[model samples]
Target: MRQVGGIIFIIILMAVMFLMDWYVYQAVKTLLPDNNLVVGKIIYWTFAAGIGLWIGFTFFTIMREGHISTRSQLSLNLFLTLFVTQLTVIIFLFGEDIFRTLNAVYQYLTSTDTGKAASLPSRRKFVSQIAISIAAIPFTGFVYGIFKGKYDFRTIRKTVYFKDLPEAFDGFTITQISDIHAGSFTDYDAVKRGAGLAAAQGSDLFVFTGDLVNHKADEIDPMMDSFAQIKAPYGQFSILGNHDYGDYTSWPSREAKQKNFQSLKEKHKKLGYELLLDESRLIEKDGQTIRLLGVENWGVGFHAKGDLEKSLRDVGQNEFKILLSHDPSHWDEQVKKHPKNIHLTLSGHTHGMQFGIETPVIRWSPAQYRYPNWAGLAEEAGKFLYVNRGFGFHAFSGRVGIWPEITVIELRKA
Candidate 1:
């Protein structure tokens, strides 16, 4: 909203648009037939105009109000995503054209023939055609991700064996989800169905590894009833993620941000989750107890409010502990280093960046670059961490290769 920032943003967006338009024209103008070219031009210009209008709307709105709400957030996120993917396509096609140009330059300089003119090489129609075809694959997939992939909830069942697990709790089961980012969810029925599926797992304990909302507490207010359906005898436990503190959005004042944080904590309670804020709880059976500890938001470079020492303050060193810290980076950087043995840690702040390839043969996501233990389970000498990909989408509005996830982990004593 600031004038200088707005002007800079406008300049950058204009430059990007100009380059994109040029590349798009050069890449596909010649391939379409005359009839199709007419339609394509209409489509192209309409799309370009839409982007321009969206940019104006977003900038002006933010300039006037100094911030954006859900409506503007949604529009802006969509526009940026479209811009990035289109830019990628443009870069690829431009690289192809540059190669052709260099070859043409070489041909002109090297030729020795007389009279025959050395005409600059024309773009290969076939190559342009292939470029577009290849680009369309990802474009179509991204469109589908926005429409369908985000809501396609898939439950992942995993069994982990632990030699130090208590014999009494050997067969304990936990259903874990993370990064609800409730602000971005659209369909109630679809979300409810996901919650239903998690409940249907019938685990002894249900846990959410943080990120209950995007930037504010009210995001989850409407969906309390649906989430409350998930219950376990031991109860539902949750920890805070970086986003839960309302740090990503602009607020009227520090007091407002604090109030928003309080409301988010209350939302967790209302949803039947015993929100663990740098605290510990004991899950006891007959004469045995396993410590369930949780900390506030902690990440290597993010909002690191989670206090591992405080959370484990009075707990005994020998107790079999299950710690819930939002970011896996916390586990890698801090939890694993402590002398007190933490048998298991559950986290999910990465969300796999909402895109990646995951299979038995290969598990990969851009998130892995930032957080080594970005998804699934990572193990050290005797400690383990399970990073739930995420339960909901965030800024991008939808997921792609990394669809929304529900994880069911059954624990067994080795």
Candidate 2:
């Protein structure tokens, strides 16, 4: 029944997409009238048909195969890029349509001399021209995102003040990255550069919040050496994300799934990270200490393997603590109001939807609608949560405004 419903949804989506293409085609005609640019028109419709067909094929493949191949990943990226371009054109053309309709209604209502009301004005050619011209911005952006933006690694530095922070660890720096999604990477050098950037931060401790792979355990094999290069004096530690459980994919048997999971854990060790599964570790510097806790993937509407209570075991109430959780939703639902004061929580998973605008004056992403603390830092009741945009791209294979991030956090004593 579920599969049938999925097929129905796909069919409806394809219909809507094709209709959008047809509407956008009218605007294309306005710019390059049927008489002109025969080859361009052929190219436009061919590309549109290709995109629509590819999108349908990709979804069906995911539904049947439980994962997308590398080629399909590229197709998804192209489809998304074209979708953004088409949607932009639609916005302009739709606005012009609204204006035309309103003008016709207004003329009908206030006509002092109504002579069968003049036929509704034809769409001005300039409107479609402007729409096509303006749409080039996102079309170019998506193209750039596909080729360069995904590897445009940026290191974000943040300093947080804590009143009760241990004096020895006053200037403690922790470098964090999450959601590697190794299987999605196409460029080995770019991945290395990102890891190199994190290593260059030279923080006191390094932590990976979660999501080492998209599905299978072997995904990280190629990049193992690259990531293993990032090491901190306090050592590298990590926790699992929902993807690490292999829940979204099909496995031949429970035993096969368990083996993949075990291999994933082993990969973490090979990368020099201690995979913390609902566990705690104390970092001591100059006889002072801070507790670092890591929980499994805990998220609302997703996996709930994280056990906050178990991770909190044997820890003091007033002890300074930092938690590594995969999903920001966990912090909102559980970490914020825990009986013990969890001073700080680091998370990823939202990836800022891998697209959106972020500037000094305004920060926005589609990820916000789902996870309130989607990107950057959020503080409530003196507890801080910093959500890394993500260290890698997934599913879509590209990022627009939200570039991959390498976070450097300095813990300062107030």
Candidate 3:
């Protein structure tokens, strides 16, 4: 049954990709001048060839890696096909006009329109394109280097005086890190850097909000020492994310997946973290109690398996609560309106995949639309949500505006 379902999903995904590719090709072709048949053909063929080569190369590389069998090759191939197709589509959609406009400006500058070239719309467009492209080349190279280097580590600290903090937990500081996808693109250096940054904050408590590994539990074996360095006075706690469940990749059996999860939880224990799965623990300070609730991956339409109600069952309603949830959507739909209001929710499933500028006034990530409170701090119904951008890079293996974060949150009283 699982095999059948997987096959059907692959079929649907491939159909969508083909349709998208066709749509983008037709759209771009329509925008070009009808007289420029050669130019249009060249553009279309070039894009097609680039996409084809990318797909072929990806498959060849995967086969060479020998991690997955040919029987499962279709699944991997589909991912590569879609990724490359989308990348090509975006390049043509955004790059074609810029290139054309630049060419026109260069022609005008070298032609008879020297005085008016500065004022002409075409000239302006050309100059803007040239400037942008020139700037983009180095920026793109830097981003590529970061991706290849797999060094997406950053620290964010905010000061909250002891007076501003809740009476129960004054001078309390929490280090939150999330989305350490420890697989092909991540290593001990990245983890060490993240831990070093977190440790430098001098946090009292450390919280890792899921996605410790990309696929399997064993994948984290290499980074155990680095992760162990992340220690705080209070304790370190963690929850499971969707990726941590090993859903994206195939396993031999359900039992295997369960075993992997159990092993991962055990690994977290070894790393000095109390792995919370629909459970809560209390931290007492100066005779006051604060509850820390941790739940498994639960999100709308994705994975809604986490049981928050069960997790918070033992805790008192008035106690200040901090929840570690993997998906920000959990806070939006469940945590905000719970019978006992969770004072703060920390999540990190969204790695801000499409990290870029929305406009001059707004700097945003694509995850923002999918998740109401996607990144940074947001408040709703008196409850606060801090969605960490993530501590490691994924799939595309890069970070843009939404860089990897080691969030040091200082709790304060209202």
Candidate 4:
């Protein structure tokens, strides 16, 4: 029964895709010279065929395996991204053909050769050229995003002043990164460079807000050395994110899933990070002490395993506290209102959708509509939340305007 349903779904999807491909073909035919039409046909058919193959493979996995692995899932994501982005650009080109078609119909009805009559001005030659010219901008941007932008890691530094901060920790610095998504990385040197940059900062402390791997624990094994490069005298601390639970991929049994998670925790250990699961640690400098709390993945609608209250049970009210919760929504739903008075919260799950615009004056991403605190820093009352854009890309395999981020936050006494 499932096989029958899957076949029917694939057929319907292929039909819709073919119709869309026809429109793209028609748009290109109108502008290209006769000699160029063969080339255009080749380009259109090749892309259309690739999409059809991926759709079939995706349906097959859903029926047989129940869930696709992170690598195959990302292939589907990249295919759709190229399909939709190019589809948008060509839709404008199709509009020009619509006007040309209307003009042709007008010309045939008027029969201007035998009558001294004015006909609707024929579509100008430059109109088709202009449409094609404009379509190139998005095409170029997508190419750059896939090849260059994803690896363009940048460090963002913010100095946060606190009037009530203890003087002993006033000049302390903390480094943070989130959403490693190690399974999605394809380039070794680029990945090493980013990790090397984070380690070079030599901050007083380092924290990794999670999503360490996309699905499997083994993904980080090959790159363990690069991540281990990160060093701080205070040591590194980490928490899990939505992807860490092996929820996105199929497992043989419940026991297998549990085992995978245990292995993932061990991977963090290999990377020199102290895996903090619903816990708090006290870091002392001179005679002053501050609390560092970490909780498991907690988001508005995701795996809400994080226990903020349990982690803070041992913490005192007077001590300055930094909480590492994987998702920013935790701040909106729990962290901010908690009576513990968490001074700082670090999170990263949105990844700014791995594409967006950020500048000194303006910051924006489609991810913001779903997560108000999608990127950078935001404060409410006296509490702070810093969303670390992300340390790695995931399904789409690239970043656009919002590149990978390594966040350095400095604490100062006001």
Number of the top-ranking candidate, with TM-score as the measure: 2
lDDT of 3 by residue, 1-414 (tens): 654565565456545655656645544554556799679878776766565554545544444443333333334434443454455554544565566677767777778755655332222234333433454553564345344433656677754332223486866889999988777443466567767877788788999999888778887888888888888888999998988888767678999989998898898999999999999998888887789999999998778889999899878877788899999988888889888978889998877652544355996667767777777788776778888878776555455556678899887664
Clashes of each: 0, 0, 3, 0
Candidate 4 regions exceeding 4 Å error are 1-20, 34-43, 59-74, 77-81, 90-128, 360-362
lDDT per residue, candidate 2, 1-414, as tens digits? 878887998899889888889889878887775667787788988988887887898888888887776777887887788788989999999999889998988888888885766456788899998999999999999989889999999999999999999999999999999999998997999999999999999999999999999999999999999999999999999999999999988999999999999999999999999999999999999999999999999999999989999999999998999999999999999999998999999999999999999999988888989999999999999999999999998888889999999999999999
- For model 3, what is the error of residue 175's alpha carbon versus the real structure, in angstroms, after optimal superposition? 0.1
**Candidate 4 colliding pairs:** none
- Which residue pairs in candidate 1 collide? none
lDDT of 1 by residue, 1-414 (tens): 458788788778767776777677777677878779889887887887787777667766766665455577667666756665667667677777778778877887778865566565777787677767776776777777778898888898888898877788888999999998888887988889999998898999999999998888999977888899999998999999998888777888999999998888888888999999899999987678899999999898899888899999899988999999999999889999899999999999898998877888988888978988888888899798999989888757667789888998888989
- Ranking of all candidate structures by their TM-score, best first: 2, 1, 4, 3
CA displacement after TM-score superposition, residue 157 of candidate 2 (Å): 0.2
TM-score, structure 2 vs. true: 0.97
What TM-score number comes out for model 4?
0.85
Which digits, one per residue and each the tens of the lDDT, describe model 4 over residues 82-189?
A: 565557646775676577677766777777576555344444446545655665665566568778888999999999988888899998999999999988887888
Clashes of 3: 3
Q: What is the TM-score of each candidate against the true structure?
A: 0.89, 0.97, 0.73, 0.85
- lDDT of candidate 4? 0.84
> Model 1: how far is 258 from its true place, Å?
3.0
Looking at candidate 2, the ten consecutive residues that score lowest on lDDT are 112-121
Cα-based lDDT at residue 153, candidate 3: 69
